[model samples]
Target: MATTTNDTTYTESELEAEKTAGSRSALAMARRGAFYLSLGLAAAMTVLFLPDLLALLVMGWTAEAGAELGIHRLHVMGIAAVVGAFLLGLFVQAYKPRERIASMWGAFLVILTASVGTVWFGVGRPEEVLPFLAVTGIALVAHPAGRRLLRRGNSYSPALLGLVAVAAIPILAFAATQLSMSSSTVDPHALDGHYVMMTALLIAPIAYGLFAALGFDGWRLASWFAALPIAYYGLLSIAFPAQVGSTGAMWGVAAICWAIAFVAVAEYSRTETSSMLRREVGHSS
Candidate 1:
């Protein structure tokens, strides 16, 4: 009879403990979601206002409120906010992830996939030579053969490190091409998108590469800066397609980058929570 009572008491205690743990976990997730939502709002507000603020300053200098310059024309600014939110989200949410260099697969995959799409679309054009080179360079880094070279003790295998460096050359050149605004110089498309493509496509990939190479420290803020702005920019391309240059391709890159980063961040959070639970179990045992 005593043993039966003791067993019931222990079972009740276990249930209570589980309930507490579950509550804590749910609260933590809720708090995290709220924080990201707040950051998203902040980003959106900044994008909506900052450019107009700049325009206000310019107007102060010239004393002209040109019809072309106003807060309402903040399509790119909205996109910038998404970039901020995305970057900051990663830093906060990716508190703990798998230690393996394999965690960076998403980082390299980002550029690799985009470059492949570019090559596929522009294969016959002489202008696509740079993107073609970039496709080769990125493929070397993202392919399984390159990842297989990563050693157990090393942060990055020598071969993988070397490939990343070699890959940088072509990628950098491709980014330069994206930012050169040549399309605008000849056809005037830059003014329409306001370098949204430059920030999202050209800058974010480089930031991710740096983040991965640096072992995800010291360069986090940069990664955030590269990421968060693209959401709004990507939206603009979809909503106002006629206004954005290379609209379809640019949208694809933005979507893929955002999705990959989000998945990485979520994985990090899940791993962290699992580790915490394990530690707690160990302590109790």
Candidate 2:
């Protein structure tokens, strides 16, 4: 009776172990399948939209020609179509969270198409037009998607910070030019000092975020340092709008700073989550 009982107990243990292994194998397969599906959807959406995008460009050209002949109607339908695709993808992804990346990629492609359409419709130096389109397109597409991707524990901090810097540089350069022009006649000292200070404040978060993303503890500490100056200036502007000269420009700078800070925080959170997971694994082992 004892021998028989031992055999039965061993058989049950083996079955349970086999079941656990099968479950793990099934889960891994599901993860791989999800990844492939997302990639395929992204690619298929890009291909399907290409022809419509081309048609939009052609329509934009027609509209531009018509405007020259005193017939003024905007070829905004193409723009609407492109925007609609993005909206549709967004909604679909909202309902199906697993497909978020695929949807974001789809929306990005639509934005790229619309940017091309804009260049085709607008009467400007193609060189000038393309750069503007590319910059704006990249910023608008990247910010929200980058935010989402980073939130998913993905290591997009470096790229996200780079995008913010790219978006900010042009604005900072334009602000500097405007400040220079205004300073030529007005008391240049006060304005110049404020401009320099604000520019540094704006760039500080970006630098810190980049450093943190690159795995530097000091960079993480520096982000807190950067935030204080930004907050101080932000409050000062609110209190003394006249002193700031351009509330709009200051607000824009503040927004960029906040974006940088948010990215830093998200990256830190990801690091902590990884650390916790590692600790749990060590304990289990």
For residue 205, give model 1's deviation from the true position in Å: 4.1
Which candidate tops lDDT?
Answer: 2
Q: Write the per-residue lDDT of candidate 2 for residues 127-191, one digit (tens) a residue.
A: 43244334334333433333454332223344435444664575467446533443333544322
Question: For model 1, what is the alpha-carbon lDDT of residue 22?
Answer: 100
Q: Model 2: which ten-residue window has the lowest total lDDT?
A: 69-78
- Work out the TM-score per prediction: 0.33, 0.32
Candidate 1: residue 154 Cα off by (Å) = 9.4
lDDT of 1 at 37: 53
lDDT of each: 0.39, 0.41
Report the number of clashing residue pairs per model. Answer: 10, 0
Candidate 1 regions with alpha-carbon error over 4 angstroms: 1-75, 78-177, 183-201, 216-226, 253-285
Residue-wise C-alpha lDDT for candidate 1, range 43-138, written one tens digit per residue: 454465444543442242242433353432333333334233332423232333233233233333443433443343332122322332343333
